[model samples]
Target: MTKIVLYARVSTADQTIEHQEAQARSAGFMIDEVVADKGESGLTTRLSERPEGRRLFDMLRDSDVLVVRWVDRLGRNYADVCDTIREFMRRGVIVRTVINNMTFDGATKDPMQQAVRDALIAFMAATAQAQAEATKEAQKAGIDHAKAAEDGRYLGRKPSFTTEQFQRVHDMLSQGAGVSMIAKSTSLSRQTIYRIKDNPTESAAALASWGL
Candidate 1:
């Protein structure tokens, strides 16, 4: 029987594999196995370079389903993501995303359908690369700002939640959990939760600024 596999990449210390699994389950994916790589930056590292990621290429068989949170989870590089997805499709593995429920299948014989799928693959891969670049730039700016504020003139307010709490909030939000529920579960105020939800990169920057 064909199996369903979920691949998760946790690049930060506070991130957890369980959170990704939960998100997949909440998205109604009946996952048969999960492969995860901790501290692997999708922007800098190719999927084939990751230990578990390499296992995915080796283990997945034709007709199997491979799921990810987003196309970005495959790789943050445009060419890399495109190549990886195309390779999988060529092998008859159906690639799906939990976030948008997007699917890329190679089984279609219709020329029009093929054109549409290929176009979407290109667009999503390019968008993923662009977003990754933007995030990295944002992080660099945040770090520079934090360093420049060493004089104590503009240290900014200390973050209210710890790194773990921040990660929990992020994970819950991605799972489409209620803000109030997440706030209560994380023991964080609604305002703080909202702030985190509104701009998670800034929230992360705040934590990094404070060396949290």
Candidate 2:
């Protein structure tokens, strides 16, 4: 039946599922189920690190087809990216890209073609890794620049709700509401929910109490 899986990841908040969905739909692929890794940035953070990404592996079976917008969506480190792809391919999984309709199939009998394919994979993986490193460096420079300008420097994504919003999240967490439910209730991401939960005093002190 040609079961298909779609994976979407955003290293930052500005990027959203809709953006990826539009890209996938334009490629003429109906996404069966999408696995998203939101707000995870480390190049070293493999699919296992992402809550949804690990689940995607569990859902995959032999002969399943996995589609991604690009190879970088899988990973940013060369060895990590290539090894994971090879493992999936070994398991009778087909890895595909929507960008160029690129397909990697290890079943090829042609030695020269196989070698060329491997070489290309290596080059692409290396490029992805380099891009990740470059992003980190550029982010650092921006942070330093902001700090010098005294523009309220803060690393990573800002809490969308501010201190007041975080206090509400903390109160909800204390009341036995699950993070997922709280996020839905408050219109914040689960990561923000946990961040607020983990830092109650700081969050509370940062703003006046709403008297929960």
Candidate 3:
């Protein structure tokens, strides 16, 4: 029997595994198992390196259907994501994304269909990677602009957490703590922890804006 597996990743604490599974379920996938990597940055971590991610790769078998929320959930690197999906397809595993209901299958015998499928995968992987880079650049630009204004006195919006709290959150993140765990330890919301982890400079600027 063909089994269905769901894989989810959250770079920040705010994102939830349930949400990803829900999306897959809504797309009509009868998931048999779920593998999730929480608070792990796709940009920095390869799929093979993640704890749950590694298990997902090992658990997948021929005829198994692997479902994800989007291509980015696989990895933020274009090459890595494409390579991983292709490897799965090569093993006769069908990979699908809930976002666009995109399906990749290696069972196609037609050359033209294979070419089209390969092209789409490349395009989607590249687009996902580009979007991640663009977001990082935009965040950096916003911080730079805020720093330049008011004779470098404008520090952007005020931060919700204190300096000590920010430092603790940073330490926890550096030590590879999970988002939920860090949020609990710091007594801050998951969203705030995400903001701190994703853009440290912006977090600092916000703190400065509040004269913290």
- What shift in Å separates residue 19 of candidate 1 from its native position after superposition? 0.6
**Candidate 1: stretches off by over 4 Å:** 160-205
Error of 3 at 137 (Å): 0.7
Checking candidate 1 for backbone clashes, the offending pairs are none
Residue 76, model 3, lDDT? 80
Q: Of the candidates numbered 1 and 3, which has the greater lDDT value?
A: 1
Ten residues in sequence with the least summed lDDT for candidate 2: 203-212
Better structure of 1 and 2 per TM-score = 1
Higher-scoring candidate on TM-score, 2 or 3: 3
> Across residues 1-212, which tens digit of lDDT does each residue of candidate 3 receive?
89898999877554678867886887788989988898887777889999998997788999999998778889888888989999999998999987657889898989999899999999878777776665566446545656567474745456788765775575455445799988886799999999888887677666555555
Error of 2 at 203 (Å): 32
Clashes of each: 0, 0, 0
- Top-down TM-score ranking: 1, 3, 2
**Where's the lowest-lDDT run of ten residues in candidate 1?**
167-176
Every model's Cα RMSD, please?
A: 4.0, 13.4, 9.8
Best by lDDT: 1
Q: Regarding lDDT, does 1 or 2 come out ahead? A: 1
